[model samples]
Target: MIYFSLQTPSIPTLEETQAVVQEVHQDLQQLKPNAILETIRSWTPGLLSFSYRLLYAAIIIIIGNRIAFYLRRFLKRTFDRMGMDLGLSKFLISLANAIAYAIVIFMALEKIGIPSTSIIALLGSATLAIGLSLQESLGNFAGGILILVMRPFGIHDYIVSEGVEGKVLNIGLVYTTLLTVDNRRITIPNGTLSNAVITNVTAQEKRRIDLTIGISYSSDLKKAKAILERIYREDPQILQDEPITVYVDQLADSSVILGSRGWAATEDYWAARWRIIEKTKLEFDDAGIEIPYNQMDVNIFQKTIDK
Candidate 1:
């Protein structure tokens, strides 16, 4: 390898450093006189300008909020016009307003130069978590929606479901409230109700009232049937289109069971049933129709003693 000569650059002298510093100071002084802050102050308007800008921004926000409210109101009105359930319509309106407010807030955030993208991501994550946690509630809500849409029963309709019989008082998002004939309040979960068998007693305009009358085995069957038929004929509430049925259904140990069925308006079902029972008792008493009772006999055998 051939040897080469190396040289180092010489450092600046003290006097040369002082000259550089002086030049930098002079430049800063020259730039400071024409700074942007002083120029902005010279061009600034009075307080009225600031107030106007603030008022304009406020008006924009107010308009946006009011628009959201009106839109929600319109949606609610439309649902009401369609004869939808009050609970469902109110829930939907609240949901719509919430969504509209969220959108308005996002737009306002953008106006203020806040990063809304991250907020949207956070909201999406939160919504997903909440939905997962409320899965069963959502399912029940859907079931309620189906109930209202399908209209299996209406208010004050007598319905039997989940081994309970009652009148439907109101239908809600998660459950259906009922008033039983015994003056009891029952709440059935929509999820269970939707899946179970539902018997709507008041779906039809008329229903059949079934009554069984038991008489003494020795009584005349023809006479008992005739008495029942006469009572049904006298009751004006009893429907004529569907004729009353009366026949000997079964022979019990103590009496002959007579089955009687008659049609009546659904609204008058209970009254009709009571009337039939009362009339049956009165007629049977007048005709000396003995309604038999169950009787049991016991025989005892004693051992004979011979002395």
Candidate 2:
């Protein structure tokens, strides 16, 4: 019979494991510096190229912005030379400036590795989204275009619309600015202004001034009429070619109303009206004419009750 011996494999000792760990740690320490250097060496060219592109884009933006500003100034001068309508000129200038800036942005983007066609596609999508979200703004833009085409009013034209009366300061892409009589600035949407009933106050070269002056019944009606006619004739601002009439407008309870009508240069309407009214008061005073005031006379009688 053959005898077989079973032998178990010997496991590694703790010292042996510790030695292997030390060898691996030393090898990693020796490779660390070279690995870092290799990484930097590999990335340097790409980093430099990206940095150059970034700097070039920045330069493009700066130079392009300056060019856009100068272009706008040139356009403004050209429009002024052409005697273009102030509102239309301003609007066109704004549009051109916007286009120039857009071109600059696209060029800068291309330098930064973004394609212009891609940008245009992105803008198309964005515009569609914005158009749906901003319908009112789009309406205002359309209205502005209509205003430019229709020529109903212009910059510096005094207009009254929707209870707002003022001199138009600007007609912009979406808003129309007005400077009020009291020097308040008002901004109204172009859409609203376009749809509203606008009264062009200064459109005509001449305007008629109608004044109603009331005198007491005791005062001479013919004398009051004569005074009004004389005031209209004497005023240099009033137009002599236009018909000037003073008539008995109404007979009220305590006074007779005299209606006076005169025509004057549109620009001089207020001055003529004020001057004539002042002269009428002075003339009536000298002629002993009385302007009636609203007065109430109350009479009370005492009644005694006896029980």
- Computed on alpha carbons, the lDDT of every model, listed in order, comes to 0.87, 0.92
The sequence of per-residue lDDT tens digits that candidate 1 reaches over residues 48-149 is 566665565567678889998889889987987899878777887888888888877777666555678989999899989999999999888888988987
lDDT of 1 at 21: 100
TM-score of each model, in listed order: 0.67, 0.61
Residue 98 of model 1: what lDDT? 86
Cα distance off (Å), candidate 2, residue 159: 1.3
* lDDT of candidate 2 over 1-307, digit per residue (tens): 9999999999999999999999999999989988999999999999999999999999999998899899999999998998777777888888898999899889888988889998899899999999999999999998988887686888898999989999999988789999999999999999998999999989899999999989999998888899889999999999999999999999988899999999999899999999999999999999999999899999999999998
Question: Which candidate tops lDDT?
Answer: 2
lDDT of 2 at 281: 94
Worst 10 residues of 1 by lDDT: 46-55
